[model samples]
Target: MSDSTPGRPPALPVTFRPAHTRAVLLTAGAALFVVITLIALLLDHLSPGERVSFVFTAALLAGVLFLLARPKVVADEAGVTVVNIVSRRRLEWAEILQVNLRPGDPWVFLDLSDGTSLPALGIQPGIARQRAVSDARALRALAEDRSTPGDAAPPG
Candidate 1:
């Protein structure tokens, strides 16, 4: 029961991302990756294998850093996408039964109809309290509008 029918008002996607703090981390990671690669290439003391390993290590670290800094949540008319440090999940609006952001929690959690809870790392509490709360409210509103009444179970 998506809320995107032609007659119904379209539900635009609302993306919740960490504030500008990640810019610093992204810049640092990208610089390190480039610098280490250059260093590995310029060092004549290292063998070809060593240079390759060095470059690989730098690339790996950069990839991880980029991932860590790119976590976000994209909620649209169809569903929501949660991108965390190591994994990504997509859930329909109906699948979301509740959105919880307790005082002790670091990030907001989405209570799914399947009895599982999914963490939305983008809406972190401590740093972006206001934005996170706003995001939660928007997500809850969208979920409620999309979940058609009388539907006994979540979308399969």
Candidate 2:
């Protein structure tokens, strides 16, 4: 949490993440990995090679869960960094046209000056809708304050 007011940009170097999602994914991944490995170790009926394979399978599942918890958004003095499941992008404030999180949207989106919109998965509404809305508003204010020209009205 930040000291900034509601709908206002927080201090620089703020990070936004799906806190509940990350916690659940990481916890479940660790638990599954531990339980599966223990079962593999305790099963005497299985051959050594079969136990090793079971452990490997558990590791693979845990890896996938780790990937599911990877999305995050980091905002700093230089710009905003968007980290999704498989891709990361850095954007200067001036390059972003608007930040949006419409109703029914899964996550926030950045409308860029290049005319393409980028999904910001870090601020997802799943399990934390209010937090996501606040985060989107703060990001939007930052984009409007830093990127929009002083003479122009900010976009909605």
Candidate 3:
């Protein structure tokens, strides 16, 4: 019932993520947390409340970095799930009319059947252009392969 069969262009349940970006963001967050915590502990001249504030600020920044590293795209038999910076959306294969990433675009965008475009930030070209291109192509292929002929909308 899936595309795991031999000779298929792609298998089901594929995930695309900005691996390098995520790694850098997460590592930076961890380092920031550690350094800030250490500074808070070492700076005895600062008041207790000020030290607490510094650690709290560090935690807030690290949390933001963690959120920044959370974007990803997942394609499966059911459809595709796009996780952006602060939003998540699920779409059936037929709902995605086209996958687009233009020359100056920062990330992939999905043209929906409803005449709306959704940004797929998980496949960004920030630090990895080739990977983003490949991911966009694969997503396009999957959308083409899985969409029902009559149900698919024409690309505008």
TM-scores for candidates 1 onward, in order = 0.76, 0.92, 0.89
From the highest lDDT down, the ranking of the candidates is 2, 3, 1
Question: Candidate 2, residues 84-114: lDDT per residue as tens digits?
Answer: 9999999999989989999999999999999
RMSD vs true structure, all candidates: 6.1, 3.4, 5.0
Q: Write the per-residue lDDT of candidate 3 for residues 1-156, one digit (tens) a residue.
A: 123333344687888899999999999999999999999999879999999999999999999999999999999999999999999999999899999999999899999999999999999999998888888888888898888687668789
Give the true-structure RMSD of model 2: 3.4
Candidate 1: tens digits of C-alpha lDDT, residues 1-156: 123333343357667777654666688789999999999999999999999999999989988778878778887767889998889999988789988888788888999999999998877766667666666666666777777765567678
Which stretches of model 2 miss by more than 4 angstroms? 150-156
Between prediction 1 and prediction 3, the one with superior TM-score is 3
Best by lDDT: 2
**Candidates' C-alpha lDDT:** 0.78, 0.90, 0.89
Ranking the candidates on TM-score from highest down gives 2, 3, 1
